[model samples]
Target: MKRIIVAITGASGAVYGIRALELLRKMDDVETHAIVTSSGQRTIAHETDYTPGEVRSLADHHHNPRDIGAAVSSGSFVTTGMLVAPCSVKTLSGIANSYNDELVVRAADVCLKERRRVVLMLRETPLHAGHIELMARATNNGAIIMPPVPAFYTLPRSLDDVVDQTVARALELLDVVMPGIQRWDGTSVVPDDG
Candidate 1:
């Protein structure tokens, strides 16, 4: 079974993380391990319809955010990688600087040290120089800093369609192929005028 760790932070886009868990559940060969930060729990209550427990139940195994000795805390645990959906600026800073104070950051740091793929779906906007620098640092350390920007070409009619498109792209960064993802085929290319 392939182990994939999904971490949720306090970022505004809690739905992205929830959608990721829902999609991962459909796969029989993948095992999902989840860690929800305290801030993430609060955001789930405030932003989404589902309770924190309901969200955690989607994963095959759940670990408390404070549990530093959990199975995924070390590189030896052997995971495909870790994905931080809706990664907050604070969490991004921690990962970029190699701060392992929390399980989420620690697990991400372990993945980086082990040369494993770490995809961070940063949900912040109005980027400043500091945010850009941190993003650069994280990228320098082998983290794919993916912002959940909606693709309009997909012709998404509803909010759920937009969320699914973003979540599907995040899974692709982890090299996990999900069925039914709407991708751009580039078949209808438009000519650009100089």
Candidate 2:
């Protein structure tokens, strides 16, 4: 089974992370390892119907944010890569600077050093120069800084549709294909006036 690490932080878009886990669970060949920050737990409670325990149960394995010595904390534990869905700015800073202050950052750091993909679903807005620079830094370190931006062309029917679209894109970076994503076919771009 291929392994992936999914991390959730204190960002406002906790649903993004939760949706990512739920979708990943659908793939029988993929095993999800999750890390939920203390702040992330609080955010889950604040933002979604899912309890913190429910979120943890979505993954094949779960790690504590404070567990700096977890298996995922080391490069020896091979994985497809790490995805920090709804990544908090604090977590982004840690990954960009190689600071392993916690398991979430530590695992991402290890993945980077090992030349594996690290996708950051950064959930922030009103970016200042500092945020842009950090994103650049993380990009320079081989991390994909993907904001959870929705594609409006899809004409999403509900909040769940928007979430699924973003989550599918994130998983695509890790080579996981999810069904039901409304991909742009370019045919809708032009009206056939015939």
Candidate 3:
């Protein structure tokens, strides 16, 4: 089974993290290992109906963010990749600086050093130069800084569709196959001849 690490930081958009895990859990080929940060727990309560424990149930394995002894903390620990759903600005800064004080950042570092995909779903809005710089740094370090931006082209009917579209796109960055939201091509359904 392919082990995929999913980290949930204290980002405001808790639904993103929950939806990502819920979707991943349904996939038979992927084994999800979740690490929920302290902040993430608070966000779960404040933003979503599910509690931290409920969310953890979606994963095949769960690790505390503070657990440095976790198998995923080391680069030698093989994993398909790691994803930080709704990654907070604080976590993003820590990751950009390579400050491995916890599992979230540490696992990300491990993924980067091991040349594995690390998808960061950064959730801050109104980003200034500093936020932009951190994103740039993360990108330069082989981590994908994917902000949770919506796609209007999909014409989503509900909030779930919107989040799913972004989640699918983020999964695409991890090379995971998902039925992403259908996008409209500029041209017509059939080829046009002048």
Q: Summarize candidate 2's per-residue lDDT along 1-194 as a digit string, tens digits.
A: 88999999999999998998999898889999999999999999999999999999999999999999999999899999988988999999999999988999999999999999999999888999999999999999999999989888888889987898889889889988777666655675222221
Runs off by more than 4 Å, candidate 2: 189-194
Instruction: Check candidate 1 and list the clashing pairs.
Output: none
How close is each model in CA RMSD to the real structure? 4.5, 3.8, 4.0
Mark the regions of model 3 whose C-alpha exceeds 4 Å error after superposition: 188-194
lDDT scores in order: 0.91, 0.91, 0.87
Model 1, span 19-71: residue lDDT tens: 99999999888999999999999999999999999999999999999999999
RMSD of 2: 3.8
Badly placed stretches (over 4 Å) of model 1 are: 188-194
Candidate 1 structure lDDT: 0.91
lDDT for 110 (candidate 1)? 95
Roughly what TM-score does model 3 have, to 2 decimal places? 0.93
Question: Candidate 3 — which pairs collide?
Answer: none
Show the colliding residue pairs in model 2: none
Error of 3 at 112 (Å): 0.2
Model 3, 30-134: lDDT tens digits are 889899998999999999889999999999999988998899998787899988998999998988999999999999998999999999999988989999999
